[model samples]
Target: MTGIRSGSLVAAVLSLGLLAGCGGGSGNQPESFENFTAEEIYKRGEYELENTRKPKDAVKYFTEVERLYPYSEWAKRALIMQAYSHHRARDYEEARGAAQRFIDTYPGDEDAAYAKYLLALSYYDQIDEIGRDQGLTFQALQSLREVIEQYPDTEYARSAILKFDLAFDHLAAKEMEIGRYYLKRGHYTAAINRFRVVVEEFQTTTHTPEALMRLVEAYLALGLNDQAQTAGAILGHNFRSSPFYQDAYAQLRGHGLQPEARGDSWLTRVYRQVIQGKWL
Candidate 1:
């Protein structure tokens, strides 16, 4: 569904008529379609997809091919193309169903990789802005993980890996957003909980530096000077070049203190674990 759905595949679909030469002309005729061979009907689907740009009609023909000859090789190819056609038409649920069916029926087929990718994309493409429910993002992450782990050498895996990282970062960003909301309302402990999730569980995310800096803000707001100072110290040590670290340093300095690990708070535990090889 991303980036034009492969124009090369569309081109090949359009060329199927020439390759077979049996029903190229009468394939689109509804009256002739029922009498057409499996390949001919499948080709008609591709013809609608590439030439007429009618995916709904393409899906009709593709589905018919699958229904008429469920065990034929053309049925296998038609089923996957049905998924592609549904995806191109933005019928994501239908696309997912067709894609999942293809994967279940032909797990070892070469096109199964493509079917799995389509299934993952069915979820990945639904992710909206951060304010929406993150259930879709979580599903996207899981499906993308499948593509990465099961087909790591494929191009689909590479794309899935990239999307997986972005989805992971999106989760961290959501935590940061809620953390900032709590911090703005002076709910320091609630804000700290959200920021800590990013620091501890989402350390690789870009939001971690900001989360640590926010911990400094929240702890300082709660008058937990040692915790605030320790948070600032961790920010400066791990993300010295980050603007968040600089802001944390300024926040600590404003309190007549400086960045140093001088607390027994959770952040101090993190610092000990990271800097002193101590487990908490």
Candidate 2:
């Protein structure tokens, strides 16, 4: 439901035809489906997913294949289908469980990459918005990292990298939101803490320039002129072309100050690293 759904109508019909070639049974009832062969049951699942769009029903049929033919090839295929179906049905918890089971059971299989991707997607899809709890964002990052690290050669890994960047950016966006809120309320120290996280932990994200500018604003409001200048120094060194850097520079100049590392605060340490080419 989140991201793109795979498979076209033609592909679904072709898959159904292939599964039908393996067996010949058309059952509508649960009892009748139980009596069908694994291939026949799998074909039914495909039909539910593609034809009727009843992903929950598809899950039932796929589960039957796993139950009736646990050691068969159909069982392995059914397990993955079960994961996909649960995801399509928006049952991310079930999707994650099925995908994780597939990964744990068939770590060496070709489908293992896909299973891991699906597991990561289960977490990734749940990162719907920045205002939501960040717990899922962290889980998504961890899972996406696994895909990138373990299955680097796969297409899923490439996609995982893209999604990982977005998720990472999402985290930076949340910090900026909280930092701006504190800044707007004149809570300079609280705002500084939030911005510091963006500078230190999430500096690679697009929010860094703005975070540094916010630090300048907060430090100036608190009369910490040295820290303000240090923040402006970092902004100018790395993001001199950015509008945020321009704003920070103007603010520093308006106060008869300039971007300089003049204090032994944390920001001054960052400035030291910047000048040493060890910080971004």
Candidate topping TM-score: 2
What is the clash count for each candidate, in the order shown?
A: 0, 0
Show model 2 residue runs off by greater than 4 Å.
1-29
Best by lDDT: 2
Instruction: Flag regions of model 1 displaced more than 4 Å.
Output: 1-32, 276-280
Q: Candidate 2, residues 16-119: lDDT per residue as tens digits? A: 66554434444434454454678878887988899989899789879989988897999999999999999999999999999999988889999999999999
Could you estimate the TM-score for every candidate? 0.86, 0.88
**Candidate 2, run of 10 with poorest lDDT:** 1-10
Give the per-residue lDDT of model 1 (tens digit) for 1-280. Answer: 6546788677656556543343345554444445667876887788889988988878978887888788899999999999999999989999999999999999899998899999889888888799989998988999999998888899999999898999999999999999999999999989999999999889888998899899989988989999899988888878899999999999989999999999477888888876874422
| lDDT at position 236, candidate 2 | 92
